[model samples]
Target: MSNFLPTLQQNSSNNFQGDENNLQKTIKPQRGFKWNSKQPQKQQHPAISSLNTPTHNNSSNSSNKDIIDFNYTPSHQLPYLNNRNFNNNSNVPKLAQVSSHKDLKKLVETTLNSDSVLEQAIKLPKGENINEWFAVHTVDFYNHINMLYGCVTEFCSYDTCPKMIATNEYEYLWNINGVPKSVSAPDYVKYLMQWCQKIFDNEKIFPTDSNVPFPSNFEKNYIKPMLKRLFRVYAHIYCHHFNEIYEMNLQVLLNTSFRHFCCFTKYFKLLSNDDYGPLLELVNELS
Candidate 1:
């Protein structure tokens, strides 16, 4: 395992509150948001009937969409040799859109597809701005996990997953306004993705102009929170949707994206040891 895989400290009680026991299946019939009823159903946990399709309409307009509508096509799936530097995802800033950021993205993409992940994880191109490196990867990971969840939305319904727990041991309670509340898996993930997208969209937080420098607190304030929450989404997918992903033949995609995420976050130290706790075993395995 990489040196970064050391077991992390648990979250302080006040910061995150949850009973560290197995997720208890409630007897109440799943009563909230349901996916498309017409879609095929899958075997599910007791008391949670498998439900319908995604809640949001799949439309062309990508505005105020609870889950961002933008889609990401991984470079590996493309004719990478012919199109290595042609990233068209507008949601992520090409801090190098008119310059060298495209090259950086291609370099990172190559590293993701390369065998020596640990060695390449810490590399920053000579004379590259570390903030720009973090910015691009941050948005890319968001697009990736968001797209992956969209794939499993049919399975990850409010009724199926009543509470946002990776397992019985690690439950994620979202702090709505101020209070920590247990919400449905889809809703919690929706809120989480939207929040991260909002941050990523803010020019003040992530400037697109080359002359402007990112704020000093960018790493501590923005990168840390975005990635820590992103990891939770990854944890949920691994815990709840791995079988579905494997059946879909997207397991390699998920695992590769996750490993790339681990590489960037661990190398940059954006997330602390405690933040990796939920998926520590997977981190070790994937490492």
Candidate 2:
């Protein structure tokens, strides 16, 4: 019985050692087991091996390098990131290369002189919905004026432009409630921008839904006043700030925008003859 017990113990010990060896083989530590570390290190999974391996593709290497060295610098001059210049080899539009008055004029003429555009313009608001037509044109004019104003805002300062009146006029005063007062050009521009912004922001007045009834006398009261103010802005720019416009090389854009506005207003009989008195010759020239 004592000899049988010894044999049984030896057999049990051999089985336990075999089990331990199988477990070690299954685990297969990436690095051999370390005695110094208190905790057993986890072996890296096979999936992670690809991530550890270096890539040889040139494009991938350049992209990785760019990612590693990426940094952002804030600019105070402009609000948005600059767009990359179009490649000379690429088939970019000629308008994309516009930097001079001649280039701008060519682009403007190419766009406005198109038979399709003129035909479309002539047939605007084909249906009898004047409110919708007015709303559409109002938004269009607002955007155009906003862009023109933005182009020269940096240069249009109180120091440079003391009065709102043109060089030829004695005084350009805005009257309200039987009170006539002259304001600085910058202040006048700010007021015009605010007025337009208010109209644009009011969805109730200029609802996107066609079914919504436009506010009563919106065209007579709101639109007329808006157009009058816009004309004054145009007049002021033409008379006092032509040099600034020229310097910015935005003459073609300004001219085209004004011509379109004049055509729209004339087609609808929105503006009286007197409203266009100041810019009559200039309008004729542009047309």
Candidate 3:
């Protein structure tokens, strides 16, 4: 029984050894591998690394291109060409200016006189010198001159000649006929205006010296004297009597005063009318 026990023990040991061998075969490790072994994955090409890296060409290219375009061009330069030729040194032509119609008329009148037709038409009657006829017919036959004496008496106390204001008054009222007390004022106003027209016509003769330019002072000194005479007549007519006719005439006279107040109030253009025509215009403006 002891021998049998020994043999059984030996068989049990062999069985254990075979079981160990089977376990080794069933759980064997893969061949040719180590914990640190890899082919390094055939290192991917640098081109592939470059593609993954952040690059300005693709990431910021549109914005960078916009900046370059903004900074590259100058605004004022001629579009495609690099150089420009500016001609700042040349002189520009100037346009001529035109004179107004009224100014043109005055310019002509200042230098010229009426042609022959006016002179023949305005000649004095046979056997009458011009000045004598003008004085006798136009001055109310010295009645205006006589009134000048009264004007002197009434207003001559002031430093300046009463003739200044007084003559203007006298000329405005001279033609009213009948005794001064009874004379109607409208008739007086008309008389004065007509008298002024006559004096204006008499004084404005084309200067005897045709070659000489028309004097600038002719209207102021000569034409103004006539208007002032009329103004004096205006004053006297108003002063002596107050009436409805006088009031109406006074309003008319005042309304037209500006026409007279402006220097000559005449149409002074030459070659258009007789020199006397401007004097008549002066009377119209004043009266």
Candidate 4:
């Protein structure tokens, strides 16, 4: 596992910057704005309807447009831990004992291959309450970003990443609660993390139990926008900071985590085509 880890990491780093010019050409600068205040009349897309696996009949009460059809299976296969000289019955190491990157890597390899672990990781509750699922994944993605960016904080600064946009030109703006602000990349990411943290920390909106109702317009107003902004962080990392990630020898981890995230969001249609278009090349290669 250790021997293959370095090789996989190296391969991911080598291909991480594939066809930058092509990516730049395809990327349309995202606009800064809030969602429409009024909900659009409910319209159903066959593709969306086919994918939905709702646990409740909230569709009769809420706008069908707001409900995502999450019934479709993911087309892409996630990367798996290579099993060698492994027994299924072997006891897996506890997370608290993982004290180093090497230990963490081993833990990941072991856990990912375990059927019990994979089932838990991939399973989502059947319901109209997408907030629970969204909240869980949101925290998961934030942890990934924290690890990936935290590794190279010294290199991630205003002088290095002057603007939040991946391209050198100022084509994109950071929109916070409907207001656009142009700032350094580090600052933009900082605010983005803060916003996500605030949402995750709030118990009223993201309750621990399944019985609680999410605030009205929560999915349309907050969850969707949060996902869009999160994709920007991914864009910035893949476009600008991949080399730094390579230097830190964390490419494989980043690649695997990012691929999982892409597949998860894609399954739910959480990201728009324009939002993920820039990174599609990399995403395809990783898949």
Best by TM-score: 1
Whole-model lDDT per candidate: 0.56, 0.48, 0.25, 0.49
Residues 59-151, model 1: lDDT tens digits:
333222222122223322222222223334443333222224344335445545575754454456556678766766676677688777777
Query: Distance from true position, residue 37, model 4, in Å?
Result: 30
Model 4 lDDT per residue over 1-287, tens place: 00111111000001011222322111101110111112112222222122111111223422322222111112111211221112342522322355456665565555433446545455564432456556556656665665566655666678977777644432346554455657787777676665555554444555433445667766776677777777777767766766554444445566657766766677677776556545655554443
lDDT over C-alpha atoms for residue 90 of model 3: 32
Better of 1 and 3 by lDDT: 1
lDDT of 3 by residue, 69-143 (tens): 001011111111111122331322222222543343333333212234223323344653333223222223123
TM-score for candidate 3, residues paired by index: 0.21
lDDT, candidate 4, residue 101? Answer: 62
Q: Which ten residues in a row have the lowest lDDT in candidate 2?
A: 8-17
Q: Taking the candidates one at a time, how many backbone clashes does each contain?
A: 6, 0, 15, 8
Q: lDDT, candidate 2, residue 204?
A: 57
TM-scores, one per candidate: 0.63, 0.58, 0.21, 0.59
Q: What is candidate 4's TM-score against the reference?
A: 0.59
